[model samples]
Target: MIALLLALGSSLAYGCADFLGGLGARKAHVLRTVMVAAPASLAIELLLWPVLGASFDPGAIGWGAASGVASAVAFALLYKTLALGPMNVLSPVTALVSAALPVGVGLIQGERLGTAGLLGLPLALIAVVLVSAGHGAGSSRPSRTALLLAFGAGAAIALQLVFLHQAPADSGVAPLIVGRAVSTAVTLTAAGVLRRRLGREKPAYAMSAAAGVLDSVANLLFLIAVRSGDLTVVAVITALYPVGTVLLARSVLAERIHRGQLVGLGTAAVAVSLLALTST
Candidate 1:
């Protein structure tokens, strides 16, 4: 029960960060946002380390680094897709795919579902769709390339979860910290190259750094949640981050929620209930 709550909290934080990062990227550069966010995340991690009393194994470091790379790629692509495609189409598609992979992997690894959990599956799907639904009632056409990139991002996200889950529990928070560092480095390097080509660097660099900090913190919370609970349940709850994204969009971006989104929210509530019931 406690783990599930932590996972849910992580999801909310992550969703807000993603939404804000996306907005920040639009106002600046994707790489820039990542660079800024990374260090902020690292600082938070460092601060929490003593309290968490987390330690890491060498193998955990490797896996964390790999997850970091995957995360960097995923966010880069996700932001790029958001820039090019409609939020309604891109967010849901990416989120659904991302959630599905871990669930599928868990099943393959022999994670069993109770009756409530089995029923919750569809609700989870509906919740994702609902939470990601946009207010663009008239926008129908979406770019194929953007959709493909979103799918790629989703795949990367799934891989991130898989690697995180595989990290040894005794490895403590080392994997997560290392993963954030690697992700931050990779994103900054990529941003540097892009900025050099475009002849613009300052603001972009700053933004990426800020975004990187938020990303790192979010990852740490997720790691803590996973360490304490079932990975499948934690992953699913965390993946429901779109709910936070939608709420933020409504407030900060003044974006309107459609009827579908309301339905989605309701469905998500049901899904959460189901997940809670099943986790027991």
Candidate 2:
């Protein structure tokens, strides 16, 4: 139950982070935004180190670094996909695939659940699709390249999440530290390779920094959640992030609330309830 709550909290934090990241990306390239934001996020983690306390281990550092590399690929591809076409179509597809891969991995590991929990998975997936639905130009016509990139991004996201859990449990936040460090290094390399001029454009500091803080917190919470809960359930529940994104869009962006989104919000509530009730 506590783990489910942590996962839910992570989803909300991640949703807000994504919203801010997207907004900031509007002012600059997403890769550039990430480079600045990753260091900001890493700074936050460093500040928390004395309070949170962490033990270091080779295995944890290795897995954490791998997860970071995977996350780097995921975010780069995801933002590129967003730039290419309608987020309405692409976002949901990415979310569903990202989640389903982890669920499949959990099953392969012989993780089992009750019928109620099983039922909630599909409902949560439907919620993802509906919540990610948005009104954008050319949204109705998605490009093949965008679709492929979205799928690849989803897989990378899943890989990151799954590998993060592979870090030794006693290693504490060291894994997170390593992961963030790796992300920063990778993003810097990507920036150099692409000749992206970071901070040359007017920095959307407030939104970008807020995104960094929230995303770091979300990753910490996800680590805690996966340790205590079923991987599949935690991943699926956290994938409810699109619900928060939709709500934020409706309020902040003045986006029209689609009927399907409303239904998705309600279904997400039901799915969360069922999942929480059944999770060990």
**lDDT of the structure predicted as candidate 2:** 0.86
lDDT of 1: 0.78
The residue-by-residue lDDT of candidate 2 on 1-280, one tens digit each, is 9989999999999999998998998897777677768998899888877887777779988998999999899988888887887878898889999889998998898888788888888898888777877655343878899999999999999999999888888777888889999989999888898875554676577888889999999999999999998888999888888877777977999988888788888999998888977875
Q: How do all models score by TM-score?
A: 0.90, 0.94
Candidate 1, 1-280: lDDT as tens digits: 7777887887887887776677666655556555667777877777767876556777888898899899888977877787787877888889988888888887888888889888887688778867776767348766789889989989999899889988888877778878878887887788677775533534455445555555666677777777777677777788889888888888987988888888888888888888889777
Name the 10 consecutive residues with the lowest summed lDDT in model 1.
Answer: 198-207
Find the candidate with the highest TM-score and give its number. Answer: 2
Candidate 2 — worst ten consecutive residues by lDDT sum?
A: 130-139
lDDT of 2 at 168: 89
- Indicate the residue-level lDDT of 102 in model 2: 90
